[model samples]
Target: MAIWNSRFKKSFDKSALKFSSSIDIDGKLFNEDIDGSKAHVKMLMKQKIVSTSDGNSILKALEEIRNEISNGKLKFDWQKEDIHSLIEERLVEKIGERGKRLHTARSRNDQIALDERLYLRNEIKNLLKLISDFQKVLQKCLDALPEQWNMCVKLKYLTEKSGEEICQELNIAPTNYWQIVHRAKLQLRNCVENNWFKN
Candidate 1:
């Protein structure tokens, strides 16, 4: 099964059309990727897997690489297997044996999973903030009208529509759509009832 899955793994066959070769698609995550490296380094230090000096050196090298990549001084090779391998290779070149120790006990699977979880956690927080801002906008729209003119039913309809729009925009799965909408509706209700627009 693993072999079959690997067979179907995605490939990047085309060169990045960005300014620099290294400024490719993966370059967009340079910050997050560096942050992940920092976290991994801290974990390695805590586990005593690598000495403090080595860890610090690895971090410094990563920062320099990040700056180089950011400034377009670095160029990515299309033939390289993947980003992690490419990074490991660069580290080895920069810091010798100590750089080689960075990947000890770490699997590509776990590394990719950690990076994805970190990204999704951040995305979810941003989405929640967007939802809150949307609710605030709706509350303001409600406040501009008199209390008697404040149509709960109209507001409810708009809220439902907004939820539907969000589900559609996010491509939310049918199974999860209702739950997400329910939560959004509850948030809208709270915003409306609390007179959140008073401020």
Candidate 2:
């Protein structure tokens, strides 16, 4: 607040301050925010915008802040602006002058944007893993089917082929293709339900 007040004629209203605070909302983004800040520090050092020693100190203090937040030694105060300010404030407190350099080459909005992208990337990775696990379960069910049934399912669903193409590919008549597809459907459902749903 003191930093922000320097350019103002008078203090901002306290009620407006409470209304504008996003600390509680963005607190969950702490890990992403810390990660974004660390990356910023490294980039600044690489570009010579921030000295290596100063960046190192800021990084060290940020790591300490991360650990404290992780171990419940630090807590977010909703009265502050957001996680960016909170971390920056803590960093300045920890390493004094060096911590101020952490904000070089970035703004508060830039921090949240980077944090969100990193957070989304991590969540997307987790989603892909879950999809892979489900694919494994589905693969097991497909494997348990007869060879022709497996091929039928693969061509129709996995390969996104039409019934006519599938019949031509499998060298089966339309009636035979339908019969195999129906049986495959039943067997695959039973297999997945037995092996996947119960668990």
Candidate 3:
């Protein structure tokens, strides 16, 4: 029986249940769900919505469940409609009545939204960091160029133009073009070795 089956007289049809299930879409939210539940339980305790003893038990069980999932000791059940239900079921199994109290103040909509926001906020932070690092590398590579060599390096590698194409674009003769390309390559190589790839 579902954790929410109390109001319904009969179980949902299997096909209907699968259609409404969010387990597949929200499966990646296991950790976020546990985190949100823990925060809710903590708030419940602070607000006296639930006793400290019950709150402590719920948090401990959640931590254990998180570890179990991380270590592959627990496998999520796809039959559960979503991570919220799966975790609530596990919590109840672990600490019985205390586990049921974790959801005291929040609806499923609020809980899921909080978890998703937390997850997306963390992901956005990581993406920003990656983009910042990439920008730094690009700056370092560009700064490595000698003032006069900068144009040649940018043309040859940054813009991905061949030596002959760069010469044509820059209106330089082949002889001078090859010389600039050679010096630019050497400068870029040393710069990368020093600024990026060195020990």
CA lDDT of each prediction against the hidden true structure:
0.65, 0.86, 0.81
lDDT by residue (tens digit), candidate 3, 1-199: 4556688988888887777778778878888999888888888889999888888999999999998878878776767777888888888999998887877778878988998998898989999997787668657777867655678777776686788887787788889887877887787677667765653
lDDT against true structure, model 3: 0.81
Supply the TM-score for candidate 3.
0.69
| Cα error, candidate 3, residue 189 (Å) | 15
Q: Tell me how candidate 2 scores on lDDT.
A: 0.86
Residues 73-131 of candidate 1: C-alpha lDDT, one tens digit per residue: 86665444345656767787899989877667777677777767777889899999978
True-structure lDDT of candidate 1: 0.65
Model 2: which residue pairs collide? none
Clashes of each: 0, 0, 0
Candidate 3, 135: how far from true, in Å?
2.2
Q: What is the lDDT of residue 119 in candidate 1?
A: 76
Decide which is better by lDDT, 2 or 3. 2
| lDDT accuracy of residue 137 in candidate 3 | 69
Report model 2's TM-score to 2 decimal places: 0.64
